[model samples]
Target: MSRKILRATYAPQPQGQLTMSEHRAAVKAVCVFPAGVYWGQSYGPRIVSGSNDGSLLIWDPETGVTNRIGQHEDLVNSVCIMPGARDRAPRIVSANRYHSVRVWCERTEGDWEWELVGQHKHFVLSVCVLPAADGEAPRIVSGTWDNKVLVWIKQLDGVWKSELVGIHEEDVRSVCVLPAAGSEAPRIVSASNDKTVRAWREQTEGVWESELVGIHEEDVHSVCVLLAAGSEAPRIISASNDKTVRAWRERGDDGWESELVGQHENLVRSVCVLPGAGGEAPRIVSGHDDHTVRVWRERGEDGWESELAGQHEHWINGVCVLPGAGGGVPRIVSGSEDKTVRVWREEAEGGWETGLARKHEDVVLSVCVLPAVGDGAPWIVSGHGDHSVRVWRERSESGWESMLVGQHEDVVSSVCVLPAADGEVPRIVSGTWDNKVLVWIKQLDRVWKSELVGIHEEDVRSVCVLPAAGSEAPRIVSASDEGMVLVWRAQSEGVWKSEVAGEHASRVSSVCVLPAVGDGAPRIISASNDETVRAWRERGDDGWESELVGQHESWVRSVCVLPGAGGEAPRIVSGSLDKTVRVWCEEQRKGWEEQICLQLDSSVSSLASYEHYILIAQGNQTVRVWLPDEDPEGQHMLWIKVPASPCDAIWNIDPQAGKLRKPEIIVGTSRGLATFTIEELPF
Candidate 1:
């Protein structure tokens, strides 16, 4: 009954069937929690931060504007800026839990885009960038849970060149690029779950050599490099689960010396070096699960002084220092699990202040302002990769809390809110990978409980509910990959019964129920991988009438019935893997008519009809809203693009009772869902 909901936001991928690179590039924002903050080497006046939400937040304190860049489907753990020496691009490289790495850039129009340039076999935990020089490209280094360190370079032809620099028996958790001044070549350093730190130096183009610096007794999480005051030898600093930040100094060829910089009460998550000036040793900032940000500065040569820089309500996952950018002295930024991104500034009194609080949480899949739920406000519901669903209440427009609801053991396949009869409370039904259809109901105690119905043998792929046929309650029809369709209904005696429709030769992918017409029983229409769309009707004199309504050259994956006119034959519209949508209508009840195929350019993934409009979801990741009878020349009315291809969609165009605000359209993909409102259509 307890539902887990992810609140991350995902923008739409473009409508042009995008290549993998283009698809990752167009994401307007991913939901990174902003745990890692990278300071300089970026453009002027910008601080970029990374979070588990799979996006980077670029905060310009001068303008109070936060721009989000890049999008990954999983957790984004690390971010680093490529030094702006490259004239073609001032870029940011990030690593994510998807075991992939990406480079983000800005266009002349000031919009952000990303390219999936590379990755590792397991979660990509950390990334660092070495600046470009001598007309050569920058080096991108990444550490991964895959137990490997990878170095990435770009050729002049815009092709990515990569090499495996080192291998560890345990996870590589953090990576850092040493300042170019002190190494034979640009040196890249990594921290690992194997309790060791490894440094890799580029020997020649596309080649590297590695050596061990020091080992931690526990997992190491982050690493950063500091250039000494008068020496070319670099110092490496690290944070680890050992609850300490340690600095390692270079010895001879591969020898190193370690010094404990500071200690924390909990596990340290991230570390960054503050650029040193005049006579001070460069300071180090460390964030930890103890919810505190600490500064470590040298008291004497071997002694260190630790000060409290900031405190957060939750774990401080990342910390960084921002250069003045032609304003003032440097400032420190921290990202936390309490849904806040804050900064620490030094006051005129030489004391530190950490009151720069900003909320940079996950994205909101918006719902319309409604009166039914959310404390008489609109409530937003979202699905997460954790296979949990969350409903955000409207206490303050962004307010939400976790509550008990039906849950899916895997990613939820489908969600439908059944319209209740006689003004009763609505019920929610969800289909999932567990191959069961679960119905959630709210009890008198205001708690939600789930009732499971094992109807499908394989994953339950789609579900739809029909207007009351001969009964008062809506009839539920579900489709599945098991090649069967199920119909659930309530009997007059208050008992529920189910029927199995086994007409499909392959997987039944989508289902739609016909609205009631002139007292005749509402029919159920289903589409299947067998390359046909079939209509089923309850025959008063027999069991059921099954008719093959539409045929295609390939699999029929989506189907929707146009709202009939006062009990007329349902006009069935379907989309297929054949790159076209075909309409099937009965001509005087004898035969079905086929219209000229509309060109989609890719496989059609879904279809939905509402209020003089038919929305065709094509594999190009666009939802094209078409008007059947209207034309200027001939094109869609509006096209909406989403980050992922929409697998299903619905229109809540009908106004609900109690003056509830209705979301005009809700689009669904395999990984995310989005909703938008259109109060007035051009039609």
Candidate 2:
């Protein structure tokens, strides 16, 4: 199936991340550097990240460009950029959970390649680059689950050799090298699962000695060093499973003391330091299991104040800062369990904002937001060209989650939610190109099951649930391309009986069940390619009959019934290929008469209504909301531009939920599904 990318930024929360498949792979590590540092092109700052899906990607945040550089055999645990001279091509070192560390570098021809540089007996959890001194090769330090830290130094012949640095009582969780001071040996800080942070200094040549720095109440998950400025010594920061981030500073004569920098509601997974400019205090950024990244800045006398930098739909695993270039504001990049590497930019007025990027594999054919089931969020149902039906629910943290509920033998053409019948559960009714209408319901075991309820001579084009009037069992109406409409009635023992309700001179295009008026029988409305809209009703023993409701200059593509304003007669709304919308109202003597006509720039593909608001999906890649009763001149019309041609749209509203709230519009396009709130549009 072809893949499509969608970006939504209508909500006030945060812009979304780069989303892949529904089974999202976790992003474990992220790092950022100057664009020209590793790649041949200069595109400002670039972000590189490793994911649990085994893929490594390089992203240019400014241009929204991405390149898959390499893949690993297992999930990558950590990543860091190799410090090198300006003339040398920088390499990215990544440690994976599969006991290996690899280096990725750009080739002479501008392509990318990777090679294994180090190996361990157990999975390596963290890796960092140590800058090379004069006449010496750069070294790489890695911490592993084997309870040891290993140093890999390149030899005179260009081969890398690994040696033991120090051992921890428990697994080493993270490691980082501090900035080298004048004539001082390199220092490395490692955090461990045993709740201790250790400081290792190169004694002579390659020999190293370790000393305990501090301890946390729980496992120390990550550690980093701030750059030393003026006369002050460098400070060490650590994130712990105890849900706190602490900074350790050296005392003149006494041992090191730790001060609480910030606290999270959940475990702090990773932490990094952004060196301050001039004499300002360095800012600390931490990622947490609560799916948030916070920036902590020292607010003299008030201690440290933290601002929410960004949020993920799942746990945040890693975070890094991209230094500002040419006086630009630094950007924060976060890797999340949601399988996305998000770029957060500082706004001019302070705070941060993100952009949305999502990918879907198949075209979405139809979408409908189900009636709110309970006090929780409402469920959204969609039909796809890949013969799959999916239901989406909003996650408590943020973002929407999807689940595959049903699979069909052919493309699902339409879908609608069916109200429950007596003690039966609510159902999802779908029509397919295979000439079948299937009813899906939640079984006692909580699994969804589908049953074939009706068959048509040709492809079923549309399906809608008939309004349940009084004690009558729930019914469904379906339209087919064979110029026929069928009604499926609920029978005893959960069985359904189908009967022909209407026939047209040409193929039927759409169908909608009208709301019951007073104590009258349920009515069905059908739009056909014969350029007419028809209403069907049962005349008791005379069976069902259809009569013309309105006509268009061209083939009618869609039809919807709108309740009369206040207590007036109901109205029929239709859209045609002739690029016009007409509203039909029942007159005392003239029967159904066209009361309002609107000319449009393009043909209307679909039509839906809630109250007096008419939603029109047009062929011109736009969706428009019209209030015909209030402003007929289109002064208050709201227009939305979509990336692709909109196929169908429906208002996500549930009156039974009580209390009025902002309604969202769910639109199915030839590419994917799009949803956004229709808040505060002028009536």
Choose the strongest candidate by lDDT: 2
> What's the lDDT for residue 223 in model 2?
96
Tens digit of per-residue lDDT, candidate 2, span 99-201: 9999987652223567788789999999998878775668899999999998998877777899889999999999998776677766888999999999898
Write the residue-wise lDDT of candidate 1 on 1-683 in tens digits. Answer: 21112232433321211001111111211112222223323444566666654556565444333444544666678777775564455677778888888987654222355777785778887787766668776788887787988878777778787788888889988888776663355688889999998888778766778888999889998888877777557799999999989989988865999999887789998888876644556899888898888888887776788888778777877777867545456777777775456667766676687533432222221111212433354344443323454554433344334343545666465666666654455666677656877776667787767776555778687777777644466777888977888877766433457787546888787888766556567778899988998888877547678888878887787888765555556688888876678777767666667754565656777787765467777655566777665632236356665554455665643335432245356665533445545544445
**lDDT for residue 664 in candidate 2, whole number 0-100:** 68
The lowest-lDDT stretch of 10 consecutive residues in candidate 1 is 17-26
lDDT of each: 0.66, 0.79
Worst 10 residues of 2 by lDDT: 7-16
Candidate with maximal TM-score: 1
Model 1 regions lying over 4 Å from their true place: 1-77, 81-98, 102-123, 154-161, 182-184, 228-233, 251-255, 275-282, 300-302, 310-317, 321-416, 428-464, 475-609, 614-680
Regions more than 4 Å wrong, model 2: 1-23, 37-40, 108-110, 277-279, 355-683
